[model samples]
Target: MSAKALIFYGGWEGHEPEACAAIVEEMLQAEGFDVRSEAGVAVLGEADLARFDLIVPMCTQVSIDQVPLERLCTAIEAGTGLAGFHGGMGDTFRDAPAYQFMAGGQWVAHPGDILDYRVEIAQPQHPLMEGIDDFEYRSEQYFLHVDPGNEVLATTTFDGSHAPWIAGTVMPVVWTRRHGRGRVFYSALGHQASEFTNPQMREILRRGLVWASRTTDSRETGT
Candidate 1:
């Protein structure tokens, strides 16, 4: 059976959660996933969650009640894959450390806000990084407090042009890890749907999503 994916999106409208959800929903559907998209986290539950093979939380900085957040975490621990990008994954629920812990990172700041930056491939041979090259683009250069347990796939060096204190500090831009039996993936990209329009960004994000999915087939269907 095709894998089932649940995308729960809402929170800071500045991140354009709806547009991001549309992009992800289309990608997953094109890849043969049975996709269900929702507007709020409250609709999620442990029982209904069991039907999905993957969960994509596209929420930005918003509060998720403990019960639902706990249920989502429990589902991921039980083997439901989890994946997201930017604030949706990294900067979500600023007060909830557990969510950040499960995501493997938290956005502390975006030095230079929106500007040109290079994404360095840290793991050139990882499946998620396949067919992609270190590239330059303009977006928020997210400075994150990342978990050491993450198997980093890509990184970016802070030139300190905007935040001089962080000059030359390297940060992880993409990573993957395990949450119990579940696979977890995150990218410090996708500030908005437009960010994914870049071929490299789109390719990397799509590959990461496929890699983090619970399905056994990891082939890229060119979504």
Candidate 2:
């Protein structure tokens, strides 16, 4: 049977929530996942979440209620993978502490318009990054406030656009972290559908989903 994936998208329409969800759903389906897509958080239920092996949220700048937020966190902690990119994942739920904790990072700022920037692969040996080389793309350079404990998968040197003074600093653009028994993967690359549709970006996301669904227990305990 194909692995199941669920995508919840909504909040600010300007970010193309529905379109983003469609893109993600299509990509996962192409990879043999039984994907489901929804446009809002309202469709999510505790039972609905428990049935999926992966969850992707394409929401932007929105708040989720405490009840559903806790439910989602619980699901991840039980080993359901969570993955997403850009405002859809990082810029979401700015007010909720639990939501922020589950995502492992929060979007704080993006200085310039979509401009040419370089992404440096930090973990070339990691399964998600393996076979991928550093590349440059013309897109928004996200300046994020990331968790200190996250396993950084990719980074970019700050350019002078947002703050010229901080040009030399390396900022994380993609990362993963363990949230209890589950895995979390996030990439700050997709500012729009055009960017997300890039071949490199699609491959990165595909590998990330597979990596996020792997369990250490299954590897060790053979369960």
| CA RMSD of each candidate after superposition | 2.7, 2.8
Q: Over 4 Å off in model 1, which ranges? A: 219-223
TM-score of 2: 0.92
Candidate 1 residue 169 C-alpha distance from true site, Å: 0.4
- Name the 10 consecutive residues with the lowest summed lDDT in model 2: 214-223
Candidate 1 residues 21-87, lDDT tens each?
9999999999889999988777675347867898998888888778888888888899888988999
lDDT of 2 by residue, 1-223 (tens): 6788888999888678888788878878777788888777885653567778888988898877878888888889988888899889998889987878888889887778768999999988876787899998778888888889999989999867678887788999989888988889999988887777577787888777766654322224211
Error of 1 at 61 (Å): 1.0
Q: Evaluated with TM-score, which candidate comes out highest?
A: 1
**Which pairs of residues clash in candidate 1, taking residues 3 or more apart in a chain or in different chains?**
none
TM-score per candidate, chains pooled? 0.95, 0.92
Model 2, residue pairs in steric clash? 9-39
In order, the Cα lDDT scores of the candidates are 0.86, 0.81
Best by lDDT: 1
lDDT at position 79, candidate 1? 83
As a whole number from 0 to 100, the lDDT of residue 89 in candidate 1 is: 83
